[model samples]
Target: MSARISNNLRSAKAVAAALSDSEDERLSENSNDGSVFLVSNDEDSEIEKVKGEDVITEYEDDDEFDLETEPASKQRRLNKGADRQSCRGSRSSGNPNFSTNTKNDDMDVETPVEAFRVLFDDAILDKIIIHTNEEIERVMCLLISKEHQCQSIHKKIDKEELCAYLGLCFYSAYFKENESCVKDMWDDVFGRGIYRATLSGKRFEFLNRVLRFDDKNTRSERRATDKLAPIREIWDIFIQNCTNNFEPANNCTIDEQHKPEIIMSYNCYKGATDTFGEKSHEFSTARRTARWPLRFFYNMLDQSAVNARVAYNLNADNPRLSRKKFLKKLAFGLVEPHLRRRLGIATIRASIKKIIRKLLEIDEHVPAVVSVIKENTRSKCHLCDSNAVGRTRMKCPNCLRRMCDDHRTAICVECSAAN
Candidate 1:
């Protein structure tokens, strides 16, 4: 029995020796691969320490791992200080020149209308008229039936009508009535009478429907590279005008509350923007529309009004001049040039002519002859059939343009004497 127990013990010792050899071989292989296994007397404690050190080393080696030993609050303070230093350095070395660069002279802004023209002048109006007429032509071409091409559609939009349309737009914004329906605003009883007086509801709707800043035919090609292709041309003109007329102060801030500067040079002018926001909200011309380009156009109109007011106030220096009054004058001024041209039209109603003369402050005067035309020579009447009328002997003495008897105005001696 003693001999059998010794044999079993020998077999157990051989198995234990085999396991120890395998463990040593694995450790030796690990060491060969540049792995260091520390030897310590306290095996369990040393194993735990090595495991902890391995985890720390892996974390440190990771590219994305941030080694922030400091508290979060302390770290944030350090970052803020660094940002402030950079901002201060940039601002100190930047451009120092800042002054008003008004393109208009004092004499040019003698009247409210004149002052308003400093920004939205005749050139802008001409461009709008051209584009509006082009849009009308496009719509006309699209109409398949004669019934679809109404008389209004056949008649091209002129500068006078465009001015009236813009005047109504401005009026709507000024009264904060843009939210109101067009029919409601034009209502005889509850509605403001100014809208109806300025333009017929249908005409106003038609103009609004066709109003465009750019040609639609070329927009696709332009839009490939320019996202703002729709309003780019007019927007460029407006930007250029603003740049020429106004200049920012030395300490101008873009967005103060959200984007603060390191060293705020001017705090007093800070409230100027806030004040403008509040006032512009009160007189905002923005109308909700699905078309982004149309919405952008509305914003442009609103900005134009505000800029005109600024230009007027700067030049006029009239403390008593209210925005409401200035806008009224500005609208009239826009319509004035067109109204003057309409005065020469023979088909215009007597009542309308009288109103135009009154608005223009024109005194009745006798027509004089500058020169006599050759008896044999005949010219078409300026007011008749788009210059297709039968030649006439009559001509305007002021402009020396040919006209018919119906186109001539006859004034009483007393009226002419008064002038």
Candidate 2:
């Protein structure tokens, strides 16, 4: 019984040996195939061994592998040597031709408003004005009730008022009062007086409500395919302006995650955006509204203010300008032209006239002395009705034209009070 058991154990050992020899032979035969088996080894040795195996498999069917009978290590060394020699041959000392054609840097931009205008020019303003007026008219047409019609009787916004509205928006941002209630902002006791002086609270609220970037009638059609249909036209214009005005450096990268601190400091793109968000949040002109377009408009204004600062700083010759002062100047500059236009109306108060003149740097018109000419030389008043033929010896010194007493009196009042 012991001999039989010993014989079975010996047979089992022989069968295992035979199976091991067959596996080794199969592995050797399939070695040329592109199959890799991982084995336990030192980290560096494993890496090198895998790399060596990869190189051998890649060139297995090549003429180079057929001609070379070297060991795997010798082959790897030869490949490394060849790679080094190829790199040396391909290396060049010549510098790459890279240049920036940024128009903002080359521009003669001096003020914050001028820089702001680079992004939001008259064309954009005109577009806003047109759309805003269209929106107002549309709302007015929809008002069938007498009470609603009376409430909607506000005049359509013009270029000047639009500018003033934008200026006020910037002013709100500068003062960090955007989130404040309109009543609080316009309060005589605690509010900044400029808000009241620049625009009526009701007028501002009306402008904000009707301010449109695009035509509402056509928006639905465009919205079917465009996610940004509401502000697409304005956004396109802004993007084109940015592309024309600014050019990024070649070394700039836009990676938001795992960025090196040094790279973040050098690249203004991310820094500017972050600063814009921070500063805008501190003084955002956006109110909590259901309309996303208005929020986007507020964001555009914020970005414009930030971009304007960068543009303003491009000129080193300018005085050190703070953001508040910069925004004040920018806002005033935008509203000044419209204010001057309003001065032409006769109904404006004398005190308001003097203020407007001072702000516009206009030399007040001197009161023209009415001089009498010889009766023979007197002609019909230039401003009088042709049928009336009111001949006057009195002549307006400013226009150097003959005027009747009625026209002359009106001119005298305007000239005297303009100062």
Clash count for candidate 1 is 0
Backbone clash numbers for all candidates listed: 0, 0
Residue ranges of candidate 2 with Cα displaced over 4 Å: 1-101, 104-106, 144-153, 251-273, 343-419
Q: Look at candidate 1 and tell me the lDDT of residue 97.
A: 39
What are the models' TM-scores?
0.55, 0.57
* Candidate 1 displacement at residue 340 in angstroms: 7.5
lDDT of each: 0.62, 0.66
TM-score of 1: 0.55
Residue 190 shift from truth in candidate 1, angstroms? 2.4
User: What is the total number of backbone clashes in candidate 2?
Assistant: 0
Output the number of the lDDT-best candidate. 2
Distance from true location, Cα of 323 in model 2, Å: 2.4
Model 1 pairs in collision: none
Report the C-alpha lDDT of model 2 over 208-327, residue by residue, as the tens digit: 888899888899999999989999889889878878887755533343432333331232234433444676676566775779988998988887886677677657788868777787
